[model samples]
Target: MPDQAERLRELVRHWELRRKQTRRTIAVASGKGGVGKTNLTVNLALALKEEGRSVTLLDADLGLANVDVVLGIPTTYTLAHVTRQEKNWQK
Candidate 1:
């Protein structure tokens, strides 16, 4: 029932109280294709971001990496770019 700003403040307070380094890794994988893994991952990232948590979505499907396609964003950099040292992970 709280507004966005209030909810974010609550999250900030919660994090401040905890003050512990917490990290989570979620992987969406299925033996079959066309199972909406990318869609679910993208939605989860968006929801986490809305909750004021930093989210990074990495599509490791080297065969057909299409997270950018689902997000409708042009791919300017990728894992290859990072590996090649052309781009850094912070970017």
Candidate 2:
């Protein structure tokens, strides 16, 4: 049986092949707080980027956008702005 790293590599390879046809989304969530969801999401995005894939990490938490805090990126706009059509989501 393949190890954890090997399984992840295989999954990445599968995604890489499908990436040319369409985009993908991965969500990290937990019903409880302080469960390291943000940490895992950030690290997973970074790892995917390191593997030569384009990744966009979107934090949908309207109240506390913790992903921005974890990444040390000050967000001037969020999904709310995008929903209102005031900001482009791709930007």
Candidate 3:
């Protein structure tokens, strides 16, 4: 059996390959706003980025965006821009 670390590395590699080929985007949502969903998402994103994935987090919660808050990130853009068609979904 493979060691745990090796298995994780292989998993992440496979994930990154798929992410790159598919150019995937995912959302995390919940009816309960304060349930730490954003925190978990941001942590996973940062972990992937730290492991060398080029990641972008979109706070798609309309009026209640929170990924930036949990990740301590400040952005110059928002879903408002997208709603207004001011920007396409690119980084």
Evaluated against the true structure, the overall lDDT of model 1 is 0.88
CA RMSD of each candidate after superposition? 7.6, 7.9, 6.7
- Candidate 2 global CA lDDT score: 0.86
Better of 1 and 3 by TM-score: 1
List runs of model 1 lying over 4 Å from the truth. Answer: 1-16
Q: lDDT scores for all predictions?
A: 0.88, 0.86, 0.81
lDDT of 1 by residue, 1-91 (tens): 7899999999999997675457788988998999999999999999989988878899988678899999999998888888789988886
Sort the candidates on TM-score, descending order: 2, 1, 3
Error of 2 at 24 (Å): 1.8
TM-scores for every candidate against the unseen true structure: 0.70, 0.72, 0.66
Worst 10 residues of 3 by lDDT: 66-75
**Per-candidate total of colliding backbone pairs:** 0, 0, 0
Pairs in clash, predicted candidate 3: none
TM-score of predicted structure 1: 0.70
| Candidate 3 lDDT, 4-91, residue by residue in tens | 9999999999997887777667777788878888788888898989987778877788788876776676867889998899988784
